[model samples]
Target: MPKVVLVGERELRDLVPLDRAALDAVRGAFLALASGRVIMPPILSMAMPEVHGEVDVKTAFVPGLDGFAVKISPGFFDNPARGLPSVNGLMVVLSATTGLVEAVFLDNGWLTDVRTAAAGAVAADALARPDARIATVFGAGTQARLQMQALALVRDLDEIRVWARDSVKAAACAADIEAATGVRTRAVGEPRAAVSGADIVVTTTPSSAPILFAGWLAPGQHVTAMGSDADTKCELDPAILARADRLVVDSLAQSRRLGELRAGVAAGAIAADAAVDELGSVLAGTAPGRPGPDAVTVCDLTGTGAQDTAIAALARARADAAGAGLATDL
Candidate 1:
């Protein structure tokens, strides 16, 4: 039996933060995905509608990496009422050469949150205008707050706007972000008002219906829809996809099945076989990103297994270097 390291959330948090290095790790994952050397499969998900919960299992194998990761994430919307968190999960890293478990991260979804936020930052960095200063985010949840913080890492944001169904939560979220990022932040009652004059707009809600309409978008704006990671969720109107000057997705196959593109194709707003660009391709310079300053671009991120593998690999490397975590042979 090989020795396996068990790392908890506290250590993982200290190891992998939503910083430049974390962003770089996620960026490398995208680059590897674009290089066609990564082996990532479709997400395995199970819906527990009775409890209003769902669990997703994702993993990927990246070339040149010593190990890969498998992550199991669960989201229970009603858990808050029971004094429990809505999201929680863990990750297991396996040695690529030996096919043995190398480490288990009992992060309880902390790594997922960090990597997801990093992906948003990477998408914004690659697609948003270099001079982007204003950002609007929909949803007053953990992801909404993290997305704003992540965006600040790559862009010099002058202001941030938050809009959610619950006005009080939205306001509170805004205040927290302002205090954390030291950027002017406010809560907007109207969703359109929140998006108006914003250079970058991110939707982070798990809305089943569209929250952002096509008419609300303007030129020179970049939209990142990170909420629609399932077939049942949609944040942007289907027409938004048709109107975007450039449409990019984390994965074309995943987007077509789970992201906004699914709704776009179903509504006949976009061609089912349209030639869309992947975010990895854009980052790799193989595909264009932001045709011009005035072009409207949209990137739909349904999340990816490659990110899990990347972040997990980083965490393990950091733990090894710092002599952290508990090693056990089983």
Candidate 2:
């Protein structure tokens, strides 16, 4: 019989302890994200006026590991009226050799948020300047909040400026981030102001059009764009590629086909080989990052399956140590 461990969000809250271990795991996993080691298919979603939702199914297999895990995150984005989050989901672990169902983690997307945030931190730690203080974050959603928290773990932040399409929403998001991270967070009136003078910038919006312009950034800045995980979504202008001294992506192939690089190449703003490096190469010490104090770098992260595998492994280990998971015979 295959044993299935069921873990809920509350249980996951206990499983995730904010620390460097989380960052390391995600970074290491991502460094090896390419070469078919992990499998993260695209998210399937649908939107109607009455109902809007998406399912992100991710799986990762590390060679020599006992098992691999898959996370099937399905959530409805229309629950704001009910005072609930627009994002929610769970993870499932499975046996590698037997392909049997091993565990089911019902975290309601908390673990996913943490893992994704950790990924952002990893990207910043590798590509951003050591003394980075100011950070500009786009979007006032859950990702914006988590990205801030994750970045705090990597850099010594002084102030954070946030921008959303709506001023009220931007202010509200900034306030929430300030209260949570205790950093000097403020809302910006424009997207450019949000990035101006900032050593590091993060874009987390879901916009299909460009939310940031190339002319707004200065040298010696690092940018982590998290909005364009799909082909239909883009948050930065293709011309921005010309401003970046280094363009590092989580996956080169995926970015070429669907990320900001795709649009940049399509628009003739950047060449296909213009990307000086990828994040994995930097992490592996094969490539340099932020070449100089005045070098501008961009880290494009389109969610990876390796991240899901790493987090699922951690969750399973924690559950086993605490004896918190139920072993169901299936």
Maximum-TM-score candidate: 1
- Per-residue C-alpha lDDT of model 2 across residues 1-330, encoded as one tens digit per residue: 856888888878888754577788788777766434555555444444456766667677865456677777765777787898777878878877888877788888877787788888999998898999998899998889889988998898999999999889889999998998889999999787778899989999888888988898888899989878767788888878877888888877767776888778888988888645667778878888778889888888877767777877788888988988677785
- Model 2: residue 91 alpha-carbon error in angstroms: 1.2
Query: Model 1: which ten-residue window has the lowest total lDDT?
Result: 13-22
Q: What TM-score do all the candidates reach, one by one?
A: 0.98, 0.91
lDDT of 1 by residue, 1-330 (tens): 979999999999998888888899999999999999889998999999998999999999999999999999999989999998989999999999998999999999999998999999999999999999999999999999999999999999999999999999999999999998999999999999999999999999999899999999999999999999889889999999999999999989899999999989998999999999889999999999999999999999998999999999999999999898999996
What is the model-wide C-alpha lDDT for candidate 1?
0.94
Clashing pairs in 2: none
lDDT minimum window of 10 residues, candidate 2: 40-49
What would you estimate as the lDDT of candidate 2?
Answer: 0.81
Task: Flag clash pairs in model 1.
Answer: none
